[model samples]
Target: MSASTPGHDDPVRPLPGWFDDAKLGVMITWGLYSVPAWAPLDDRLVRLLAEHGEGADRDRSYHAEADADGFDPIVTTSYSEWYQNSVSVPGSPTWHHHRETYGDRTYADFRDDFAAAVEQWSPEPWAQLCAAAGARYVVPLAKHHDGFLMWPSHTPNPHRPDWALERDVLGEFRDAAEARGMRFGIYYSGGIDWTFANLPILRADDVARAVPDSPEYAGYADAHWRELIERYRPAVLWNDIGYPSAAEPEKLFAHYREAVPDGVVNERFYAGTPDFLTPEYATRATSGGSKWETVRGVGLSFGYNRQEDASWTTSGPDLVELLMDVVSKGGNLLLGIGPDATGRISPEQDAALRELGAWLAVNGDAVYGSRSWRVAEDRTAEGLRVRYTERDGDLYATFLDRPSAGVSAPPRLAGAAHAECVWLGGDGTVGTVTGLAGLPVPPVRPGVPEPTVLRISPAPDPR
Candidate 1:
């Protein structure tokens, strides 16, 4: 396979079981952009349609992975977190905002402004929020492509000496999460740090060319990665873009393994078979030999997209359905939230998370500590999909759309012989059958989301 191809070859066997049980993780992307916190959520699906040939299916094109032949990454990356580099491209909307907002100021000035705002930040509340949101882990951006380190850094800043914070931001988050009994992870921009090489990527294919390549940059990234492992002992070492070519993949992996014995890594780097593969916003979902994760923004942008209103964001029901879809496909969801400059989670993002948490509070048995069934999904004649999960001899059926009416057909679990079927988060039995549980839309408080789950067991216990 070419260097740009998606898959890799290495010998990291079945990932730690704890990761498979962790159905949900929350990822925060906050940085200098959060100061301005604005980006245009372009009609990305429409852009893909325009890029694909004339006869491509419009519906499929919208959801199709952008990695197909001739597929471009530029059309897919609309993240507001990339404001620094995005603004450098002459005709982009970000560039227009930069020119109008601060005529002669550099992005470094924005960094200085962000540093001033960092004084008001605290990680405890964020950690508490994640725990409440039913997240098994929390991953925050360590250093983005912008190169502004969130924590006090021992590694030299490629461009400036005073670029990082004096406070141990990552340490604070780590302590808070560990206190909450949740694993802590770090998202490092291993491939490209704009300060080292600011390559304006205008087309989809320019992504490979954008990464800075040099022993200097490799050493810089290696130092930062080692420092993170040494200081944080992160459970998840998530990398983005790609690792610098000069960086030795094998040695880095060994170093990380030594730091955190059961450390889980994402597949974005080309080093080896990561604990899991990661498909970003516009990538194809893969499953089979290896574990995988799917990361998505609350809306179209990963950074706080000021332009994204309720219409652009996923509602509670949508999120539940999304989580079920990923789990059914044997993948985990690292739901992304972009906090504003004050470090407060957006109300929209918070609400969605809490909604998922509330649902999990009632139906967590169906999600957490569960494994995907051999047959992941079963579609009814009504076009609704019922996703399956198994745990401790009990079976779970998650409906993509809540059962507004009885499903035309529901799959019978192999040994399911329940006398009572309890609707998740609801009082009474929604359905009762020996083998299959059917729902006619269980009653729920107003504004409570759908995509309900039913616990199927041989025992008739109410609890």
Candidate 2:
């Protein structure tokens, strides 16, 4: 297999088993963007034509907070100037909207807010909510491209506080989760950070552009990774944007092993291989046949998409079905939740989460600790049903679509002597399995279409 990142010529390390147990998680993304929750750049402009003409400052809060945080007020106030001059007018597709709205604010303001907000954040309730929603773990953004550290950090990011080093956000979150009996994880952006002049690596011309192998890159990596790993000791360390500019990932992995020997890492960090495979924005109905996870926000944006994009909102029922489908296929689901400026989850999002929790209370047993069945597909009474996993001698089958009424057929079964059928519901309800004596199965729709389970006993394995 390929080494982790480019030039990472080293032996691969073994992964841990707890990763298998972490089948579901909640990803939180909140930062400076959450302040104005800026609207889409193009569309918001037309809507703001009126405000702009009136000199109302389409982008407010430019330098007020930055000044308060002791940021370079003059340089910071010109952020909107830069956006208007460099991006919007020139069609540069810059994060013009983000810069215009929040560019002036320093990381200091966000840090104070984050620290205070996180302190008020009731991890107990949050973990309870996730557990209720059937999540095995919760992954919060430890650091984003903006370079703001959620936890205390003595080596502050010029713009934000060192709460990462002082307040111990990671420790508090971990303690909260353990107190609530749930696992904890973190998300870190690998290469970019607005505070770091070298950020926006894709832009290429932002800074002197040091390669990964350069001493500068090495120093940067060593410092950040060392602090995160040793301080947090996260169960899961998910990296975004990928690593390996000029340096080798083996060196980084070496640090990961030293700091968190048993922790699990995702593949986004320069290597498409980690403890599990990750699919963004959609659920995998089919088993990856390997350890995997599907990550996506409830809506189109991961963080607080101020516009409230309809595409990002996954209905409660849809969320439940998707989670069930993925788990049946032996894959995990990492759902994202966006928080507003006040650090509050949207009412709709919170309700959806609670609704998923309600469903999990009923059908989670059919999900947790389950193994995918050898057989991949089955013809059912409703239509075509896919067999995903097994739990306590029961076969769980998921219907791809709603079936028409009056159809009747027995789904194809894997090798088994006999079987009993039941729908996987909140209460353990069993339905009789009739008409399996022949082939050419019946329609699956009107005959309890969603996801149903079949109870089967296999012959004992010869020792």
Candidate 3:
């Protein structure tokens, strides 16, 4: 087997064919944070250095009580999924918010609140949305860093025996998703369970140090991993940070495969190369050496963040482009949606998903089960961004930007008639597109979000 180096494609690849065909998966990161659903996604301390001129009495002071204007895109953008750990830092933004809002209430309070709230929420809607969005699989957070289990597991949390949810969240989600023809996955915070770690994280270096490597914690995490497989039989075991250093990676992989034959794992296990490498926020985008994925929240925060306005999230058109980009680069896009404690997908998130599903309804043939083309991206004569995917012998060219009235057939496919050209949500036969004059003026309304997909076949040889 060949692997990719810094420059060229390697024949050795780490992904199973099912993963390559998957192309799109949905990740849900709901947990205790969903209750408060507060925190930024950025590495703010990095930004603070630039703001305060490099260690010059950095402003550890909290910003305005509510979502303030001029929040640094670099600073405000952060993973809300780690709210529990961030709040433990005492002076961190989440810490300040927790102290001020809940007034010294332990994280356990928020955990209980989430568990109570989830009792009223159902998993059906989440399943329906993933199906609608054309997700190949649905991965829900089973046990996040808060050490809270969504499933009623025999493997007790080393910290709290009574802490597990009464409801079988993973089972319900698995049934719901499988009912909709989507594979089920589980996200486990295997490396760092903050309840046991309990160490303050002031810096990136502190992050790794905080994972409790004690035999007790390792044994507990190992049991949870095995129990998850024994019960749910997830298709994907998405571990976070890393696995317990003591656990045997080979044994774990063997067990996962035995439980669910097609089961795959992510690179975060840190034991060795995983079935896939995951890049956050955007696609890894390196060519053909390995199976890779880009997992990102619809908004800046993975866990729901009330502070996120419309500006923080990827719009419908933008998300389509993102998926196209990732697919073109031989990767999958694990688009994340953070539901509230009540398990409601917020309106902002819901709208984008609906639009994505609608788009996929028409253009899915170009995405699902498609392989990366030799050349990933090119441009049309009209300057529209074009991404390529191949299925069978047919080539699909997806325009990143919505084509205007006067666009052209992709430049490389110049003078070539399209086998089939379709608008994202429009039916087939959009008239043959050309390089100079794009399409025959479709009946779409102005400002409505949609992209054009051109299926090009080789022009016939001179007869």
Q: Global lDDT of each model?
A: 0.73, 0.54, 0.71
Which segments of candidate 2 are over 4 A away from where they belong? Answer: 1-15, 39-120, 158-166, 197-214, 245-248, 258-261, 271-273, 283-285, 309-312, 377-381, 384-387, 400-410, 414-417, 426-463
Regarding TM-score, does 2 or 3 come out ahead? 3
Ranking by TM-score: 1, 3, 2
Which RMSD values do the candidates have, in order? Answer: 4.8, 10.8, 7.0
Expressed as tens digits, the lDDT of each residue in 1-463 for candidate 1 is: 0013244554366688889999899999988888877665656544653443222211122323454465443433457886776677777777788788878787777777787777898898899889988999989999887888888887868677787877788899889999998999999988768778855555644555667888899999989999999989999999876788678866888888877888888766767667887655422232244676767776767778777777777777778877877776677888889888878887888888888877788778888988876666676666766877878867687877656665554544533454456677777765566545344666565555677777666432221
Report residue 406 deviation for candidate 2 (angstroms).
7.3
Count clashing residue pairs in model 1: 3
lDDT of 3 by residue, 155-186 (tens): 77756776788888888889989999998888
Return the top candidate by lDDT.
1
Candidate 2, RMSD to the unseen true structure? 10.8
List candidate 1 segments past 4 Å from native. 1-5, 45-77, 282-287, 404-408, 411-420, 428-432, 435-441, 445-447, 458-463
